[model samples]
Target: MDGQDEVSAREQHFHSQVRETTICFLLFAVLYVASYFIITRYKRKSDEHEDEDAVVNRISLFLSTFTLAVSAGAVLLLPLSIVSNEVLLSFPQSYYIQWLNGSLIHGLWNLASLFSNLCLFVLMPFAFFFLESEGFAGLKKILEDLDEQMYMITLEEEALQRRLNGLSPSVECDLLDLEQELQNVKTLKAKLERRRKASAWERNLVYPAVMVLLLFETAMSVLLVACNVLCLLVDETAMPQGSRGPGIGHASLSAFGFVGAALEIILIFYLMVSSVVGFYSLRFFGDFIPKKDDTTMTKIIGNCVSILVLSSALPVMSRTLGITRFDLLGDFGRFNWLGNFYIVLSYNLLFAIVTTLCLVRKFTSAVREELLKALGLRKLRLSSAPREPDSAKPSANGHQKAL
Candidate 1:
């Protein structure tokens, strides 16, 4: 009887644990959804039509301040989280110190989780603005210069044709000028090609960075929701023997939650592939847009497409991810170094690398050339001057050949 009672008690305890986990997970899922609506609906409103110097609206100001505070708090908590870990915060043998160490770990873990969750609200929106604003001005200047060169090439071609058609003495006198015009055209074309390449390179870097962060956030949101739903269903089955089985409605909830999670995961993967395709398409076909009349429309369309791709994923993302928590030292019985690594990599390292690479490719010609070469791409090289007559070549019978 005691053995049976112990088994029953164990089952009851298991169900209780499942219930608590499910509750926490559900709360996280709800927060994730709420964050999506709050950010997408309200945060974007903050960016619309406000002057640089204008007094900030209350909603905008509150969100901005909140975002800044969360980000700052996350940064500040990192050191404390590290030092407070059981392995690092070790003290000489004392009951009080041991208790303090455990308390610190518990406190830091929760604090880090809170900050991490709050940080998500800022990351996605911040990335959109960061990438767009950073690249737009420089990219616009490059495009303008490219358009100017195309105009000059047209004029220079006409002048060359007129010079060629003129009477012998008149044309002959201006032959050198015609050659100079041709050279100018060649130079301008080269510059335009270089600029186009730079633009393409920047586009490659910026697109990936933005997409990765957005996807990561979305995946986390959906996963959390799925896990929550799963736990709740498990909790029902884990009930004590005398308890009633889960109702049909509970089963349906499990099914829908699971289906929703799977669909979201699939969608995020599709978005990633689409982002790559879109970036390449823009880079290659962008020049096909008429430089004179429709450039602005092309830019607007491009931005819309990007926004659409990102926004489409927001629903699933909000359902899944929220705050990230990592226990680096196995204090929580698992070494979550990978999770911590991902947080650092996704949020900090990757952004810096992508931004820096794009800026470098845009500004430095030599570096651009090297990058293209390394990637095995061929750049347009200027044609070399014709070689002198083969008389300069070794004579067929060199010994006695006359000049």
Candidate 2:
């Protein structure tokens, strides 16, 4: 009787997972397609000028597609694997068949996981490159050069002043040339000041975007873990009775869940700190009202916070609903909807973060060039007239006084 009940439960559990997976995949596919279309259209519009950043954007799109393809493949294969076990019992014996039947599903899952992990690694360095390439680093270099130029000019002025000491008043041309150079230096100094201000503005936007992307990646990691946990739980319940140790099954699931929860806690802290820092830094350095399309950083941070809140709420719901309990002999089931909820929330956060960083970095680079021009540092030239020889000979008394 118990065995019969267990079989019935397992069948039901399998069907439920199939349904949930189907729904989730459909939703993921829709979003993925929509995002692709939007990005493609944007690229087409921007491609006329052949902007240098176009290549970076394309790279991001490629990575996004790779991530989606691998993830979708894994999701699709999971249900097929389950169905195959029930439906295909007597295939011809072959090594390939055994490998496909036994190991392919696991391989697909690992492949999907690898793609998702690669997204993070790819995005971080990409963001850094975008920030640097957008002229943020160049601006800093220019400022340093300006400061050094100003110092050199000041040293020249001091030397010129000393040279003028005890000289007759006849060297008017030399004095005039020195004065002109001083005026030119002053003009250049003003220009450098303007460039510095512009650079600060650009940094304000790009830095926040980068920080938001990092938070988004962290949230995605949390979501991937949650999804894996859900899949694992379903697999466990669908397994035939006596196939695995009861204690080991429970211990493993619980450990995975605990680790995920711990990660959630750490991510929440990260989101909070990053958001606060980014928000204030932007306000301090840039315009408070970000341009419509340039508001990606704010949006990404907002998504991260929302996910953090949702993930934190799940443990409470799990404890309250008593959904954590599962019979080892019975089919897999999720009375705990918390895991699925967290997964969706985490994915959204990740998407928002990556998109925002990419956009902001590009926009800030454009703004930096404008600022440099406004500061008059764009191709400034300095020249001084030839110095005239001193006409008056120094008297013996004047020479003694100089000594």
Candidate 3:
């Protein structure tokens, strides 16, 4: 009777846990939907016409930016959901322990798991189907607008400065208004210049090397997600239970899931910092409009597609996937560190090869352009040179005009 009672209690406890997890999932799902709406409703158009002098408006804008950044950072939880009990973060001694101990990630794991599953099973394939929407049009428009406004502002500043200069030294009354105008013009010009710098590919965020790192980081995250998903999707009979370390519960994974999750959360924080510091960084995917015109955005979409291919698991699950289990719905025990390590190594190699190819492609194009420019310049110099008549051609060292 005691044994039966204990089993019944365990089952009840399990149901309770599931109940709470379901509630959290529903709550987060609602918030997730709301977040999109909130981001979309922000005052993007206000950027065009807001008075720079309005302290209140500026404060409101800052708050809005902060919210967007928070959402962007929240996306890091995606890895935690994907890596699950397998990663080091799930290690009891790991620092991420607090996450499951009444932390946000612990409370919201179900939602995150669902999100990660969708990203792996649904979005990855969709990205291949829609690799790109549009690109560079929005960027060109912003650059051209900045250039035009800057030129106008420069002319305005000069005109105002000239007006102030024309006034008599004793005419303090007229100088006051002109001085303020000039100051405002200068301020506006400075703002435009800053925007241009942020948008430039050569600037810090979008630099080629930085881009490669970002791509690799994202690739690793996707790989981890795939690993977790595979544990559920693959045939359970093959590996069987107890073939690895003692299985850990997902709830206990509050600490650290893996190295990748830890890195992702850190990256998310860094992303927030970068966004807040006046770089025209990526929005939290607030809108799709930029996909048509922004090269940076286009690259982001491309990165997703590339990562999906790198993280594919067809070799193991190709035949057994459907026959074995429905993914995102099985018991994938933790403690498979060796398998995880091997998988990580394999992904690293693949990512490295792809990165090298991309870098080489970039280098070759740059070198080709340089060579073309050099050849063109040489041709221009030669074609423009005067050809002396054959009879009057001078020797290399000594030549006088043969009149």
Candidate 3 lDDT at 371 equals 43
Task: Report every candidate's CA lDDT.
Answer: 0.43, 0.45, 0.43
Ranking by lDDT: 2, 3, 1
Q: By TM-score, is 2 or 3 better?
A: 3
Give the best candidate by TM-score: 3
Please give, for residues 116-204, the per-residue lDDT of candidate 3 as tens digits.
Answer: 44554665445433422212323554677799999999999988898788743456866987899999999999999988987763543
- Superposition error at 392 for model 1 (Å): 57
Q: What is the lDDT of residue 54 in candidate 3?
A: 34
Give the C-alpha miss distance for residue 76 in model 3, angstroms.
6.6
Stretches of candidate 3 off by over 4 Å are 1-15, 22-38, 41-78, 82-183, 190-209, 212-359, 363-403
TM per model? 0.22, 0.27, 0.33
Clashes found in each candidate (C-alpha, N, C closer than 3 A)? 7, 2, 19
Screening candidate 2 with a backbone cut-off below 3 angstroms (N, C-alpha, C), the clashing residue pairs are 10-331, 237-332
Per-residue lDDT tens digits for candidate 2, residues 232-350, read 45553321222243322123223345454344444434444544455546655344422333433222223323323332333232222222221211111223343454543444445
